[model samples]
Target: MTARRRWSTEEILDAAAELLRTSDAESFSVRKLAAALGTDSSSLYRHFRSKTELLRAVADRILLAAMDSYRPEGDWKQRIMSLAQRVREAFGQQPQLAAVWGRHASSGTGSRLVMEEILQALRASGLPDEEIPTRYHRIAVLLAALIAAEAGVSAITPEEYEQGMELFRVAVLGADPGRFPALSHFARDVRPLGADRHAAFEEILATQLAHIETAMRSR
Candidate 1:
């Protein structure tokens, strides 16, 4: 009889992180994780109280890795943009995890690391210390939502995305020209030649920063 492999916390989390990258939501359970590590479910249970806790740990590891890989070497805006882009790209690579990233609880050690990185960039922007906290919170939330939308769609199978888009296009074409003229007119180009996601993100980020800086100047 084969003996079960003894899994370390790091080993388990490592496998869990990889599993999250390739597995679907339904296939991402503690039992599957343990099996992947050549251990039993009880072995995983010894470390994590539940599947949710286990997923949270895996998520933290992903975030931690993302933060560590970032090398800041630019202006304040560039550094801040790099931070957001790096995290987004990291999570984006593992579409499964990226899909549910924002739904999970924050304030973990990994999150603290990321937050500190962002605040550091903000400090370099020469913002008053008092306004940093509020700006940090707002920007963090906005960055998360933007990344989620960008990466979550990526996590799905191409077939699924194409199928959804097909439906969307059909609906757009079916819209009344009198009432939804704008949408109907642009139906062909909506998906066939859509705007670049990264460019769209840059536009949004620039607008938000412009508004925030204007408000700061007035106040």
Candidate 2:
């Protein structure tokens, strides 16, 4: 009889990512992953210490993919913006993974690479050495929080998401014009609530970048 092929680390991570894509991280387990791979759970344990370790590996894999295509050739602002977009796009692929990273602080190689890239960009911004760390922390946390928020939207059904947006629109538009004249007057501006969620994200990112730029220019 032919022997079954042993699963590689890459294959295991790929399977885990696929499972995460369909089901949430809460319900995912090493046993379930082993079943999907047609192998014993011990095979997976040989590669990873535990489920948390395995998931962190998966998150690193995704970050590696995000960095694979990243080119840090642009100026500081542009490079930082591009990196942010790449990170967002990577999480967009498997938003469920973002939630995992959200709950657990990521300390993987991929996460370190991202931090290094951000620090490089911040240095290029002409920020003082002492201030770089603080700025880096702010930028990193901002990106993580915003990306998690975006992923939260992806976690829900399209209909439910749109319904929530519509409800916000109604709440704003239905307000008494006399009491909330400014809000009511501008409700039409936000009429298309869910049409371009990324636009809002990009705008917020841009604003934060602009603030950093202003600080850099002042120094």
Candidate 3:
């Protein structure tokens, strides 16, 4: 008879990550995971002390994926844009993982490495050392906003979401014609080509980071 091979921690974590990518994190239970793996729930506890540990492992794996793909060598604006785009892509690929990401403390090794790289790159760009903390905070806010926007948009069909966004554009832009000329122009542009949201996000992030860098240098 052939001997049975035991599952490795990586294998278990990969399975859990697959479940997270395909379904919501809340739906992933040890029992369900074990059943999917052709084992009992007790088997998982040997690898992951508890479900919380399992979730953390899943988060770590996802963060590693994001960090691995990040390339920080370039102009500060380009580097920041690349980092943000990679993050957005990573989350977009696993929307179910967003909830876990949002709730967890940003103290994991993978998370820290990514932040360190970003901070180092920003510092090399002539940004003041004193402003590093503020820059980090702003980057966090920008990432959270991007993740929230992408997750919300993914919840609906693309066509329906586009239509809804168009309607919102009109309402917000048309509310006060003279006071919001740029917004009115924005609505017209969006209504015509339907904004490429990812590209728009990249542009906005680059713009914001540039301003922050400028401000930091002046201080």
Top-lDDT candidate index? 2
Evaluated against the true structure, the overall lDDT of model 3 is 0.73
- Tens digits of lDDT, candidate 3, 1-219: 854457899899888888766666577789988987888888789898888778866776666788885666678767777777777777777777766676653456767776887888778778778877788788877777667566656755678977887787668667575887777666555442234777778777877887886776677
Q: Could you give candidate 2's per-residue lDDT for residues 149-215 as a string of tens digits?
A: 7787888898987789878977998989989999988887855534576888789888988998887
Model 3, position 193, has a per-residue lDDT of 26
Compared with the true structure, what per-residue lDDT tens digits does model 1 show for residues 91-204?
Answer: 877767764556664546888888888788889877899989999888878887888777767776879878877878778778888999998898666653223878887777
lDDT of each: 0.76, 0.86, 0.73
Error of 3 at 137 (Å): 2.3
Q: What TM-score, over all chains together, does every model reach?
A: 0.85, 0.84, 0.72
The runs of at least 3 residues in candidate 3 whose Cα sits more than 4 Å from the true structure, single-residue gaps closed, are 1-5, 105-107, 155-195
Give residue 21's lDDT in candidate 1 (0 to 100).
77
Counted clashes in each candidate structure: 0, 0, 0
Determine which window of 10 residues in candidate 3 has minimal summed lDDT: 186-195
lDDT of 3 at 32: 87
Our model 2 lands, by Cα RMSD against the true structure, at 2.8
Off by over 4 Å in 1: 1-3, 25-27, 106-109, 185-195
Give the clashing pairs for model 2: none
* Candidate 3 clashes between residue pairs 3 or more apart in a chain or in different chains: none
Model 2's TM-score against the true structure: 0.84
